[model samples]
Target chain A: EADIYQTPRYLVIGTGKKITLECSQTMGHDKMYWYQQDPGMELHLIHYSYGVNSTEKGDLSSESTVSRIRTEHFPLTLESARPSHTSQYLCASSDFYEQYFGPGTRLTVT
Target chain B: AQSVAQPEDQVNVAEGNPLTVKCTYSVSGNPYLFWYVQYPNRGLQFLLKYITGDNLVKGSYGFEAEFNKSQTSFHLKKPSALVSDSALYFCAVRDGEVVNFNKFYFGSGTKLNVKP
Candidate 1:
């Protein structure tokens, strides 16, 4: 099985609260990605990291920021949460062709 | 730009019958195709991939996909469908050429429903 892990599988918070979603992988992959998925919708790439100290924005624009200080970890932080930000966040690490996904974190903002 | 399209929003099939999910892609260079399945509230699992060589590639869970260069399609198929096979299916393509080849673009996803 893939060793990718995401903390806080489910979260609920009030608007304006800052939150961080943690993602870690034991696969030691160079490529890590963060995607946002809504109910019955296609997953949109939000942020990705090529490797340690390398970060880039994805096809979709997001208000969150990501950091890759360590090769195994890529964490995303939102300065202020809003209802529009409520969605399922997925973390994945790729080894060339195939990508291994985490269980995902479902965030709900009220 | 590289992109993937899964025309069907949903595909329904009867158990014990053959089933297929359609996918088409557009890429600048040769295509690196893949299929992933996701259960409800769960992460996606790698089912199969077509990197090169054989046009017909078999993957986990008795699933397979045939890559057609002429049609630019890679459709997932199963000889006999099972009710447990019902889930969301995604088709992905690796973008960029040999030089800057990075990023995997996924299709909109197709929901598969197998009826007993």
Candidate 2:
């Protein structure tokens, strides 16, 4: 079955530490997205990609950057983590309209 | 820009009772709307979508939504709520001519509580 996956379900890191969140999809979708969400709040789009070698920032400005080197993979990296960056990160993939989401990664920056 | 709005911050319903969560949207052209549910500490799961043709769309977990063009609303509903249905719900919209679907904009979710 086609699915999206995210690694490191939970992460606790100190401020200024650099970290990367991994996301992959076996669905072969060309468009991928990354979103930040707080409990019971609106999810903010932080990054998106049209396809391999193409990436763009989403509506919300993010301190993290993303790279789409392969069609199945997209990774987000924070140069220097901060306490404020602590939030749930979700990875999603879509072919046209509806999106499929991964389990998500909960990051806590101390 | 296309946008989605969920008016109620929270909705409470007794188990086996009907449930409704309101959603509204704004867009420039034709709109494609969707609903998703999130369980605690989990990712958003697609419940249903309204692309065209029908005013009412049925989805997973016995949930349904009505697309009211005049109202620009797509409210989620279930004939009988279940305790397991308690979760956060979000409504999203994509703006474009029917053929040109693109990025989506989401609403701030609504929390649903179904108690016995």
Q: After superposition, how far is residue A87 of candidate 1 from its true place, in Å?
A: 0.3
Q: TM-scores for all candidates?
A: 0.98, 0.96
**Model 2: per-residue Cα lDDT over A1-110, one tens digit each:** 23999999999999999999999999899999999998668899999898999998988999999999999999999999999999999999997779999989999999
- Proportion of true contacts reproduced by candidate 1: 0.76
Per-candidate DockQ vs. reference: 0.83, 0.83
Report lDDT (Cα) of residue B77, candidate 1.
99
TM-score of chain B of each: 0.97, 0.94
| Docking category of candidate 1 | high
Tens digits of per-residue lDDT, candidate 1, B9-116, equal: 999999999999999999999899999998988888999999999999999989999999999999999999999999999999987587546688999999999999
Where model 2 places Cα greater than 4 Å from the true spot, the runs are B97-100
Error of 1 at B54 (Å): 0.7
Please give the clash total of every predicted structure, in order: 0, 0
lDDT digits (tens) for residues B9-67 of candidate 2: 99999999999999999988988899999998889999999999989999998999999
Cα lDDT, model 2, residue B76 = 95
lDDT of 2 at A84: 97
Candidate 1 regions off by >4 Å?
none
RMSDs, each prediction?
0.8, 1.5
